[model samples]
Target: AQSVTQLDSQVPVFEEAPVELRCNYSSSVSVYLFWYVQYPNQGLQLLLKYLSGSTLVKGINGFEAEFNKSQTSFHLRKPSVHISDTAEYFCAVSEEKTSYDKVIFGPGTSLSVIP
Candidate 1:
């Protein structure tokens, strides 16, 4: 079985401040990690992914995350946030095997960037 758990459901931050969102997962076999962002009334966009390479991965809009195999965790971080960054974030995971190509999303973390 495979499962994902996002530690927080919401993260509020002031403009230009930093933020971090925690994520963890469990699977019997190997898995791929991903982070997606969704703005108000907009579709989700791929933020980053940890495929088969380095543990640390970077994404658009100055976002980054590290994949920890031992800890089974992938945490997202941003040094400075903008009001425009306010949106919902999701942590996702997919099996490495080709049989399952679907991605499973976390509950969601609402990043409220205040002015």
Candidate 2:
């Protein structure tokens, strides 16, 4: 079984400031990591993912993350943030080998970008 952990519950940042959302996971075997964001009253949208290839992956909205196999972490970061970036971020882990595998999601980190 795989599980996800989000280090912070809420992150308050001023506009144009850099921000990082920490995420960690534990699994018996290799798994895929992902970050998703949700806006007010909207469904979750994929931010980035680490399946294979590069350890560093970039996503939409100037967000990026690095997959650290040693640390079992996939932390998301943004060089600069905007007020519009305020939303809930979730970290997920899943094993793609099987169709029955479940995607475990973290509690979520609420990013409050203040102007």
Candidate 3:
């Protein structure tokens, strides 16, 4: 079985302030990790992913995450946040080397950026 967890359901931060959204996962087999962002009333977009390579992976909009295999964690971080960054973030995982990617998503963490 594979599952994802986001410790914080909601995160509030001031504009231009740094923020980190914590995520953890458990999988029996080798897996692929991902972060997805969903703007209000919009579809989810791929923020970043870890298939295979370096632990640290960078994504669009200044977002990045480190894959810690030992900890089973992939926490996303941004140096500075903007009001535009406000959205729901999801952590996902899928079996590696699968013919079709069927990702399992976390509950999602809503981020509110204050001015």
Better of 1 and 2 by lDDT: 2
Instruction: Please state the error at residue 95 of candidate 2 in Å.
Output: 2.0
lDDT accuracy of residue 66 in candidate 3: 99
Mark the 10 consecutive residues where model 1 has the least summed lDDT: 96-105
lDDT per residue (tens digit) for residues 1-115 in model 3: 7889999999999999999999999986788999999998999999999999899999999999999998999999999999999999999999876623688999999999999
Across residues 30-99, which tens digit of lDDT does each residue of candidate 2 receive?
8899999999999999999999999999999999999999999999999999999999999999976753
lDDT of 1 by residue, 1-115 (tens): 6788988887889999999999999887788999999998999999999997899999999999999999999999999999988999999999887438788888989999989
Model 2 / residue 99 / CA error / Å: 7.2
| Candidate 3 wrong stretches, greater than 4 Å | 97-100
Model 1 residue 107 CA deviation in Å: 0.3
Model 2 segments more than 4 A misplaced: 96-100
Q: Which wins on TM-score, candidate 1 or candidate 2?
A: 2
Residue 55 in model 2: lDDT: 99
Per-candidate Cα lDDT values, in order, are: 0.91, 0.94, 0.94
TM-score of 3: 0.95
Error of 1 at 65 (Å): 0.6
